[model samples]
Target: MLLADFIRDGAARLEKLYPSPEARGLVLMLCRELLGVTNYTHVVEPRTAVPEERLPELEAALARLCAGEPIQYVLGVAEFCDRRFVVGPGVLVPRPETELLVAEAVRTLQEMELDRAPRVLDLCTGSGCIAWSIALDIRDAEVIGVDVSETALDYARKQFPQGPSFIQADVLDTEQAFPYGPFDLVVSNPPYVLERERTQMRPNVLDWEPDLALFVPDDDPLRFYRAVARWAQRFLRPGGVGLVEINEALGPETAEVFRAAGFKNVRNLPDFYQKDRFVRFQTPDNQAINN
Candidate 1:
């Protein structure tokens, strides 16, 4: 079949679930990954034929996409912080906005210029995107990632041949005396989406992404934030920075979780869209030091 014919037909099939532009984008991304074709390959060649031997496999993938599986899952990777991270049904696909948290981390660690190598702890480190991003950007960074899901930790550990270390532990259990600490930075992109917010999400997300990495009780949307606060309070070096991605609707409330934990300079940070998407805070400079 001609490449243009498949693109048009696949997009048309997807429009039953997505808008026109997004449907086309998904089809284009699929073509790029499987057929090694550019977005405009069909347009330029005008008669580029999809190799006959690849037809069945391509059709099977297109069927999966039509079944509402995330394009990233079908492709088996997601681009985050300019690097592709391994991903699948059991893990949350790395979102673009989480890169901002990495940027904030890189900047804060750079500004510290500590005499010793910087240590970082990433709670709820699905796919280890933030952890790996920091470890790669700041070569001397000692980055560790934590997640409760064995599936997530598997993907996180497999992200790179060598980078951050992955730990299998629930971040919500803040009382555990997890041995690695006195970190220079504590960062997380935890489950901030409230249970009530599920209705607003796309099927590919609500159905495909793991609930363990996405939802929180509506009555207590700040549960993860509170756990992060306690972890920061216990393990962060005096004046060490802590940042967490938050639900936009709870920006001030989430920031208060840190403040209530006795953190200093607790404040919300906005994403590129100026929505309050993260809370940046620090341990009190007077806090007794421990490594």
Candidate 2:
């Protein structure tokens, strides 16, 4: 079969099954992954033959795509903050909205104006997209990513050449102590979507992504926020900052939780869609001692 014929037929099958704007894009990406052919545009310009040996691989990938496995999982990598990281059913595929979370973090770090490398923590780190991005960008900073699942940490650990640390710990455990500071910054994109909302999500997400990394109990959607805020109060240094991605509908309640935790200068940052998507807070600066 030829390349143009392959994309056309695969796209048709995906459209019939998935029926979304992402369907064609997913098929094209799968083609690139399986065929090792980077210049797909030229194949579209004319017609080119796909090697006969490649047909079986393409067919298998298309079959998996039709079965509702996410394209990222099929491809074995997810792009976030303009970098690719390995991800699969055991981990949640990173989303564009979460980039807003990373942006808020970078902005907060810059505003703090520290002269030296800072200590940073990523809670519920998942595939470590946020933690890795910070370490790569800041260069001098020491980053630690913590999650409850060792399998998730394994993928994250493989991405870093040698700088960041990964810890496996439940965030809700009352006795746990964060090893890093009095961290200069604490950031996360913890599970905020209510379990009931699963019916409303796309199959690629609801079927393939890890539920533990995506949903929260409906009764207390802010459970992670509450735990993280309390943890930060204990571990974040004086004037240190905390940030998290949140459900837009919960902005007011999130603000209340942060305030009650004694975090000052609390504010919500909106995503590209103009929804309240993240919150930032800081500990109050200590008063100077007089002579």
Candidate 3:
């Protein structure tokens, strides 16, 4: 079949799930990956025909898109911090907003005047995007990522030949003994989506993304934030910064969790859209726990 016809038809089929422009973009992206066609291939070569042998492959993937699978999971990768990380079922696809959290982490690690190489701890490090981004950007940095999902740790450990080490551990169990510590920076993009908020999300996310990495009980939305605070308290160096992506509706409450955990200068930070999407906190300078 002609590439133009396929693009038009596949996009129409996907329109049931995505907006008109996004559906077209998804079809174009699929063509680029599978058929080696540019976004304007059909426009430039009106007679362009999808190779006969590859048509079946295109149809199978388009069927997944029509079924409401996320494009990242369909392609098995997500872009974050200007790098692609492998992602699929059992792991949450990295979001663009999470890139801001990585940027702050990279900058914080770069500016630190540490006696030794800076160490970083990434909690709920799905796909290891945050961990790998910070480690690759900074030379000789020691980074460790913690997540409970063995599947997520699998992807995290293999993001690159040489990057952060991934460990399977529950961040919620704050008392768990960790051999690594004194992190110069601690960051996370943990599950902060409230259960009630599920209705507000599109099926591509609510259905495809792993729930373990995306939500919390509506009555206890700040559960992960509290756990993140405790982890930072135990591992983060004195004066070290802690950052966590947060639910915008619970920004002030999320910041309070860190403050209540003895964090100093707890503050809410807005994303590009100016929503309070993250919380930044610091440990008191006078205390040191050299574990």
Candidate 4:
């Protein structure tokens, strides 16, 4: 069948599940993924014929789409910080908003002027995107990724076997011993979406994306932040900064949580859409544990 015919049929079906623009996008991405076509406009316009072998995969993806599975889950990968990371229904798909979290991490790491390799950590690492991106960009930096999901960490280990160490552990478990970092930076895009908001999400997301990686109790939106800030106080060295992605609307509350936990230099920053999407806080004086 011709690519245009495929798109026409696929778009029509996808529209039943997604908005027009997103449906069109899925069709275009599928064309590129299956056909190795760089220019999707050509596929949409000229209507080139699809190869015989690519049919089965496209058919399966279309079926999954009709079932309200997100395209990222169907693709089994998501792009973040201009790099590909393994993703599935089991893990939260990295979003563009998280890129702001990473960019801030990179900027802060650069400013530290470390002549030697700096240590970094990505807590609640889902796909290891943030950890791997830091290692890939900073070159000399050593990164470690920690997550409670063994399945998620397994996927991350496959993606970065030697580049960064992947650990399976819950962030809130005090019995779990994290390496004494004295890390130059620690970062995360941890679950912050409120539990109540789940029903309002699009079917493609709410139906497929894992809740453990997305939603938190609305009664305590800063649960993860409070845990991570305490961890930073213990593991991060003096002047080391922690970066995190958070709900845009909760900027003040997040800042307060970090500050109350003894983190200093607390600042909330905006994403590309001008939403309060990222926060940074530095460890002060590397305080003694009792203090």
Best by TM-score: 1
Q: In model 2, which regions exceed 4 Å deviation?
A: 36-45, 287-291
**Could you tell me how far off, in angstroms, the CA of residue 197 lies in candidate 1 after the best superposition?**
0.8
| Cα lDDT, all candidates | 0.91, 0.83, 0.88, 0.82
| Better model by lDDT: candidate 1 vs candidate 3 | 1
Question: Residue 10 of model 1: what lDDT?
Answer: 94
lDDT of 1 by residue, 95-129 (tens): 87899999999999999988989999999998999
Tens-place lDDT digits, model 3, residues 148-225: 999999989888999788999998898988989878899999998888889899988888889999989988888888
Candidate 2 lDDT over residue span 127-196, tens digit each: 9999998888887888889899888999999875876899999987734755566688999888999988
Between prediction 1 and prediction 4, the one with superior TM-score is 1
Residues 166-241 of candidate 4 have per-residue lDDT tens digits of: 8888997744566556687879888999988877788778878788888899899888998888777777878788
Pitting candidate 3 against candidate 4, the one with the higher TM-score is 3
Off by over 4 Å in 1: 288-291
Model 1 reaches what TM-score against the true structure? 0.98
Each prediction's TM-score against the native? Answer: 0.98, 0.94, 0.97, 0.93
